[model samples]
Every structure is written in structure tokens, then in C-alpha cells.
Target chain A: MITAAVPERENYLNNAYGIKSWLLTRDHKRIGLLYLFTVTLFFFLGGAFATMIRIELLTPQGNFVSSETYNKLFTMHGVAMIFFFLIPAIPATLGNFFLPMMIGARDLAFPRINLLSWYLLVIGGLFSLFAMLAGGVDTGWTFYTPYSTTYSNSWVIATALGIFISGFSSILTGLNFIVTVHRMRAPGMTWMRMPLFVWSHYATALIQVLGTPVVAVTIILLFCERVFHIGIFDPTLGGDPVLFQHMFWFYSHPAVYIMILPAMGIVSELVSVFSRKPVFGYQFVAYASMAIAVLGFLVWGHHLFVSTQSVYAALVFSFLSYFVAIPSAIKVFNWTATLYKGSISFATPMLYAFGFIGLFTIGGLTGLFVAALGFDVHVTDTYFVVAHFHYIMVGGTIMAYLGGLHYWWPKITGRMYPEGWAKLSALIIFLGFNLTFFPQFILGYLGMPRRYHVYPDEFQVLHVLSTAGASVLAVGYLMPMIYFIWSLRYGKVASANPWGATGLEWQTPSPPPVHNFDVTPIVTHDAYDYSTVIGQEVEVG
Target chain B: MSEHIDSVKTYALVFAALIAATVGTTAVAFVDLGPFSVVVALLIAVCKMLLVALFFMHVRHSTRLTRLVVLGGLLWLLILIALTMGDILTRNWVGVPGR
Candidate 1:
């Protein structure tokens, strides 16, 4: 086993004085928890909007809501979930928290920029809330032209402005992570020795830095279209709406990988830890994250299959789309291989890891259908697309987020969440998630379209089933909110290494010191070296 | 360290070449290259971007991990642009009655 060069405890915990201290702190751990709290609040709010959409879909008519109101509900749901919750949930919170710690650093390279990212998130969220109160936007999250630029009257600018602001937060967070991982590793922590989670975040950060700027420009052009009537996307003004889509998806397509890669990163850690093995093909898994991120940008046009894009372009995109699947499949196979003949444990995190595997597979497979030229044309804007994304975003990303939250809760809070409730919530989330999204896949196949306030009579049964599943999904989401808060005061005090996980964070005290390590640690081993912890008698042998 | 020096020089030369190519492409755009015009401009643009990414972004100087990240972004962009264009361009190719 390799040795850890332990540093002295210099009271990094009590070094601070006020609320302002934490609010303005550059500590990665504190910033991460801060992000966790804020993103969770938005997750619930986003879910509430989703719950409303599903409830309305339970019937054929636009019951319990007007068409305009239904439009706003679904639009806000997409905006909130995509921009406010899922996009930032994993990378900004869990990745931010553990990346530095895992790399044995004091903080991200540019700590002030990190703090700015959180503030930007809060400001963006407030703008969206203001939009909701003033009325609400109904143009859908894609904000496709004609509708977003000329139609739909409910405070589109305020909501789009919020999304625009959130883009910077994403960009800044990406920049900081990239610089830190490059410049801040502890001595002896070579790139190969780093955890797969850190490598995945590094890949994700690259996309955020490069791709988000293009979207920021797109949103600006959108604002120009709405306010000034400049007609960048207005076909009447010698402008092509398709160009807007190209610009929009240019950023957005990569944005999908941005959302999923970090979750894949988190899954890597959970799978390795639970399976009691170093990740199978560590270099390959690490490279695949980057591969997915890079390839992610090329495949944005798949969203425009039935739009004004060319058939040649569609064929090429379909083929390239298939290429991206290869790297993603590589990761799945490697994870399964990692679980081969190991002393596996069924901890809360492990259950979510399994959940991620199953849901993400369904999500990925459906994406293949969407990527195909013939199939996509048949169901371009249908419920199939909706179900396809929700499976990946909600089913895959959110599951991994919660798993990471539960896995790292002890480190963040210095307390244990009730284990029984944690496991039950994971199960509920899995069942409710499948119930909520799976039926929509069939509905799409049967020709039910998305973003409609009303549907045909034939689609009602599946819609009702989907809505019923959403309620269970809500319960699944709510349990963690209840227990995690309850655990803060009443739960048992946890030691530094509650799970016997072999990361640098476990070497620090519970809840960690303000600046993270009192003095920097020197890493001399590869991550997930379970033998080191086992030799110390940390786990139940 | 030797790898770093060689890549840095390579990056610098490519960046200079990119600037020159951009100017040349814009000049050529004014000429009637027809469909080839857009293709040529894009090709030059792609080359310029590659240069910036490889040298300025330090992808070439960095480890294989970094290179993989750069490649990942490019590969995805290719899929997006290519597939979308495929559907749009092929729309009117056949005597499929609707057209």
C-alpha cells in the first residue's frame, strides 16, 4: 500500500468569524455546499412545474389550466430544470466540492471567480422568479423563433435574461475547474493518479468554457430579435430562422454532454467505491469523458432533423451521432466490468449507481432512435423526444446528483442521514422515474407531440399513467429534502471517514476545514486503493 | 519539456498561418466559387480553430487527457453539423411528389 504524507492540523475550521465569512469565502468545500443548497431549492421548484404539466396531461382536454398557462408551465419547467437545476447540480455542487479535495488542493485556482459563479446562479434564479411573478414565459426553453421573437407575451425577456445570466455562471465555473485541475494538484498527483471524477470534470469544463460563449451570443441575438425587431431569425427580413437554430444548438448540443459527463464522473466514483475495484480501464474511461464532451458539439443538429436543415447534413449528423455512442458505450461496458467478481456492497450510493446505469441506458438507447434519420423524422417533436431527454436529465443526471449528495453528506455536514430512509428514497426515485418517463416513450411512438396544452383522446391513458408516476416521483424527490435537513441536528455525529472511502477528503475532519486541508497533502497513490482503508480496519471486515 | 517546446513553436507557426488563411479565404469569398466558397471558407475556419486550440489552448503541450477533451468537443460538433445538414440538403433530391 502507498503512504499518505499527512499534514498538521492548523485549526482551519475556527479561522473564520461571520456569515459574511462563509458568504464571501473562497473555500471550495463551503462553495460546493452553498451550491448544493441553492441547486436543491431550484430542483424542487422545477419539479413543482413538472408536476403541474404532468397533472394537466392526465386528461385529454386542457383541464385545470388554460392553454397559455399550460404553455408557461411546460416552458418554465424546461427552463428551471435545464438551466437552474440539472445543469449545475452535479458539476457546480458535487464536482466543485470534491474535485479540489480529491486533487489535494486548498481551493480552485481562481477562488473569487468560483464565488462569482454562485452569485450569478442566485441572481439568475431571482430573475426567473421575477419573470414568473410578472407573468411567465411560454415560448418553451428552445425559444424557437417566430414564437419567442414575435409571439408569446408572458415576460419572455425576463426569463430568457435569467437563462442568459446563468450561462456565465456555467462558463466561469468551467474556467475555474479547468485552471485548478491543471495548476493545483498536490505534489506527486500525476494526471494518471487522479480520480476519474476529476478527469471527467476537466473534460466538462473545457466544453463549458468553449461552447457556452456561443450560446451567450445566441441569447443576445434572441434579445435583439424580441426587443428591437432586428430580425436575425426573421425570414421576412432576409434572415433565416435555421441559422438561429444552428447557433443555438451549436452551444446546446454540447450542453447535453455538459449535463451528463459530470454525472458519469460521479457514477465512476460510486461504482468503483462500491464494487471494491479500481475503475476498469481507467485511462479509457477518463478519455471517453473527454471524447463524449468533444463529440457532443458535433451532434447538435440532430435536434434539427425535421427543421430546415439539409438532408446531406442530416445523414452526416446521423453517422456522427452514431460515433458519439461508441465512447458512451465504452464507459457503460467498463463500469460493468469494474463490478466483475468484486466484494460488492449495496449502500445508498451503490443503489443510485445501479439506478444511473439502468435509466441512462434507456435514455442512451432512445437517443439512438432520435439520432437515426428515418426514426427522428417520424417523431421529431413528439413525446418521445421529451421522454428521451427526461430519462437522461432527470433519470440519469439527477439520480447521480442525489447519490453523490448522500455519499458525500457526512463529509459536508459532519452527520449521518438515516440509512433506511435513504435507501427507500432511492427505490422510490427509480420506480417513480421509470413510471413517469417510460409511458411517454410509447406515447411518442403513437404520435403524441410535446408542448401542446391539449392532446387527442387516444393518448389520455398513457398521460394519466405518466402523471401518476410523477406524484410518486415527487415523493421520491421530497424524502431527501426532509431527511437531509433532519440529519443536520438529530443524526449521529459522523467521523471523518464514515464510508471508509479512500479519497483525500476523508483524511480531513468531518465537514472539513474552511480552507480545506490545513496544509496541502502530498499524494503518493492511485485513487480507490481500498486496501489502504481496509488495512486500517476502517470498514466492517 | 522538449515536447512542450516543440509544440509551442508548432502552435505559433500555425496561428500565423491561420491569420493568413483567414484573410485569403475572405478575399476568395468575393469570387464566385459557388458551393465551393462556403466549403473553402469553412475549411480555412476549421484550420484556424485547430491552430488556436492546439497551440494557444495548449492542447498539444498538455497530456493525452487534455488532447482527448479537445477531440471530444470537435467530434461532437462534427456530428451535430453533419447530421443536421444531411437532412436539410437531401430534402429536394428526389421526385418524391411533395416537392
Candidate 2:
């Protein structure tokens, strides 16, 4: 009934025709679609590399590929996945599309710069892809030096340059978001009136602007060391290798927050909407994001506990690492509290949110295990570390990415994806993900190190089980790809507010017009104010 | 946003002070103040940075948020250097008995 009553008008999708329109368009929504296509391609490319690694690990004998090829496989996997896919996953796509809409703006402050960022990412990705195709860098994604600089050689400079270029893309996007958030909110859309998603992105942008430059500088230093034979990270040339660890993790640590904060923002929206309640302690959740961004910088040393870092420094880092978890926990607790006695839905997005909260908790707790200096001595470089991050990156970020994608699909595409398939895939991903990574925690605790092509026969059973789970996870991922494409033509037409969501984004058309709002909306209610629409069916216009 | 336009006199005065500071840095480098040489050099650099930020960059005339952004960048840099120095400084506090 709601769909029938809604008028169909020319929207972003039908506003133009052909390749030139999309390629040269300055529309934020079109740019978001561009990012969605690019990142999804990289996701599969990264996923292909992951499949190779998993299959190779299916047996302890390392029968599938040579050790060197295996090294390249995992290296490319990490490089493609982290730099290309996960880091830019939500912000470049979802945030770019919706941040302006949610705050009642026509577009981001710098639309051209937004387009440039996507182009930069494409160029950067091409460079990395060229490196992979040429010979593949085998420095593990960290590109730890002396080895990266002096010895173990394979396209290090090319790959680092690729990442360096991509880093600019990230920095530019962050600048755009920061300027837009500061200047573009509609009248009455005060700081407190903004959605938690915007709040989290604002914090993420801070980290992006401040922190990405450090990694870019680090890569530059690495470039100089490798190409110019500088004595920066090479121990034989009087360089302290540990200093590389220091500089690398300095950015890489906050880089973890870069990967997860936007995901947390998505979860904040999902939990509140599905629970039909305003997010509990909204200020705490918002400030918690800022706190995570700030505190995230102080804990980089935790990555160096086993590198013979000083006991005092390690102690300081360990303590601060624990403190960083407090803000994250504050978020988790607030989401849970928001669900108390509230009308909850089992929609696909909310299912993914539940998956994120559970898996991210496990990931965050295991981080404490690795944060301890003594404990890190045992688990550093082991599958425990591998599992811990996958839980966070895959379980936490990917789950939330998928959740946000499903939550906003109606708005982005004006079609409802087959909900039954979405829910089933979410379930498969959760089960298969747990099956794949949970055993790694045990294998790691039992002293199985990572990145090995061969292992003792005793580790074979767990490896088999993990590989089986990876197969299932592969199916889980593929189903969405197939159905999301299929849904474009055949799925149910979506009303503007299919989910009864409460954001300025929902006030417009399903696939909004060229200018998002016909007239700028002045916010009159708090975010996630579902009570007003609870009993009545949501209207499209 | 600042209605106050900086006069040429103010610019010239700051420029003269910077030149003086550069000369002072060169003079200070000639005399070894033992371990404090690096300290004095860094202090002079900080003062020069303040001059540039406050006058040249017009941070002095900027809004509170702009000032906070500048300070925030500086504080983060301090955290990186100080925390890292904590590790480098005390690395061999207990040396292994033999090489």
C-alpha cells in the first residue's frame, strides 16, 4: 500500500544514461555507487587470495603451492584486503552516500574532492594490482624492514607506493567529511541532534586526517630505505629494526580504529532502529567514539611488547590498551542497554548487528590477552593474533558493513533485497566465520605460528575444520553478491522509509533526486525517535 | 574571519625576532651546554614554531576550534615522540652479563 501511494519520479539512478554520466558525475550518491563497485571487486580479489591461502592450509604438508608462492598469496591477501577493501569499506561507500543525506545537506562540502578520492583509490589499487601481477611483495602486509628494505625482495616499492597514493585518498576523504560535518548541517541539526553514525564518522575522519599522514610518512621512509639504501630500518647499516615497529604501529594501531569506528557507527544506528528506541546514553556513545580515536593513538606500543621494548614502556602501553577498551565497552554496553524492553526486530541488518556485538566482544577481549606483555610473548605472530584481528576486522567490521549495507539498501537502490536470503546469508556468515577462526585461537594457544606453509601433523585436524569453514564462508559471501545483483531488477520496490527509520535521509525519495531534499529539513526530533511512528505505517512522502 | 588586519610593523617585528632567534641558535650551537645543548636547541625550535604559528599562520587570530586543532596535532606528535623515547631510553636498563 505504501509503495503504491508513492509517486515515481526521476531519481539519481535514472537521472542520466551511460558510462560518461557515472564516470564524470559529481553526485555523492553516484560516487558512493562507484566506490561500492570498486571495493566489492577488490573484496573478491582479496577473497580469491584468501581462498588460495585457505586451500593451501587444508593440509599440513603444504602440497598446494610452493612456500614462496604461499608467502605471496597471504601477502597479497593482506594487502588487498586491508588497504584496498576493509579500511575504505564503510566510509567511502556508505558514509559518502548517506552522511550528507542524514544531516539534510545537498552534498558533501567538496564534491570534486570526493570524486578525486575515489579516483585516487582506483589508481592506487591499480598500482598494487600491478605489483601483485608482476611478482607480488612478500613482506607480510606490515612490510617489516631490513627484510623489506635489505633482503626478501619482491615489488615492495611498487606496493608501498600504491598504498601511499591510497593514503592520500583517505586523507582527502577525511578532510571532506570534517569540513562537511562542520559546515553543512541543516538548520536545527545541532551537534547533539546528529545521528551516532555521523558522530562516529566525525571521529573516524579525525583519525583519518591526523593518523593517515603518519603511515604515509612511514611508507616514504621505507621507500627511502629500500631504494636509497638509507640506514633507517636496516640493522646491518646501523639502523634499529625496532624503530620500524614503533613507527609502523604508531599509524597501524590507530589504523585499527580507522577500520572499526565506522562499523561501530553503523551498529549504533542498527541497534537503535531495530530496537525501536533512541540509543541509550547517546552522548556517551558519541563521546566514546571520540575517546576511542584519541586513546587509540596511545596504545601502539602494545604491538611491540615482544620486540624487546622497555618494560616501563610496555607497562605504559598495556595499561593504556586496557583503558582504550573502556570506551569500546561503553559503546557495547550502550547498544545492549538500548535494546532493554524495546520492540526488537529480526531484520537482516539487526541480525548482523547482533553478530557484530558478539564477535567484536570476543575480538576485543582476546586483544587484552595479546596486550599483556607476558601473554604476548607466547601468542605474538601466532594464530591467536590472527584470529583476534579477523574477529574484529571480519566479524566486527565486515558484519557491520554488511549490516549497514542492508539497512540502507532501500534508500540506495529503491528495491528491497530478498530478506529471507539476506538473513540466511548472515546466519551462514556468522556460523562459518566462528567455525573458521575459533579453532585458530586454540591452535595458536597450542603453539601453531601463522604464515607457515607446513606444520606438524598434530595441527592437521584443526586445519581441515578451518578450511571447511572457509568454504562455507565463501558460499556465505557469494550468495549476497548474486542476490544483490539480481535484486536490482526483480526485487520489491521500496518505500522511502521501508524500515520506519528516523533520519533526515528517510524524508526524501527512496533513490533521492539530484538535489537530495526538495526543501532543507529542519530537525525537530532527536535521532532514532521511533515512538512517533510506532503505531502508524510509515509514509513515503 | 578576523576583522583585525596585521600591520606591516607587526610583521617586521616578528621577522626581526625570528632572525635574532636563528642567530641565537647558531651561537648556542657553538657552545656545548653538555646534554642541555639538545634541550636548548629544541626549546629554541619550539619558540620559533610558536612565532610561525601565532603570527605567520594567523593562528592567533583564528577561532577556538582552529586553535584546538593545531594544539591537538602538536599533542599527538608529543605522544608519539615521548612514548617512543620511553622505550628507546630504557632499552638496556638491565644489560645481559656478557656480549
Q: What is the C-alpha lDDT profile of model 2 across A1-541, one tens digit per residue?
A: 3555666598988889999999999999999999999999999999999999999998889899999999999999999999999989999999999999999999999999999999999999999999999999899999998899988869999999999999999999999999999999999899998999999999999999998888898899998888888898888888888898998898899989999999999999999888889999999999999999999999999988888788888999999999988999999999999999988888999999999999999999999999888899999999999999999999999999999998898899998899899999999999999999999999999999999989999999998889999999999999989888888989888887887888899889888989899999988888878865665454221
TM-score of chain B of each: 0.75, 0.91
Cα miss at B31, model 2 (Å)? Answer: 10
Candidate 1 lDDT, A221-338, residue by residue in tens? 9899889989789887656788788888888888888899999998999898887888999999999998898788777778878886776777777888998999999999999999
Indicate the DockQ of the complex predicted as candidate 1: 0.33
Misplaced by over 4 Å in model 1 are A1-17, A537-541, B1-99
DockQ score of each predicted structure, in the order shown: 0.33, 0.70
Off by over 4 Å in 2: A1-8, A535-541, B2-52, B97-99
Report fnat in order of the candidates: 0.64, 0.76
Query: How does each model score on lDDT?
Result: 0.85, 0.92
The sequence of per-residue lDDT tens digits that candidate 1 reaches over residues B34-81 is 889888988888888877887677677798877876776676556545
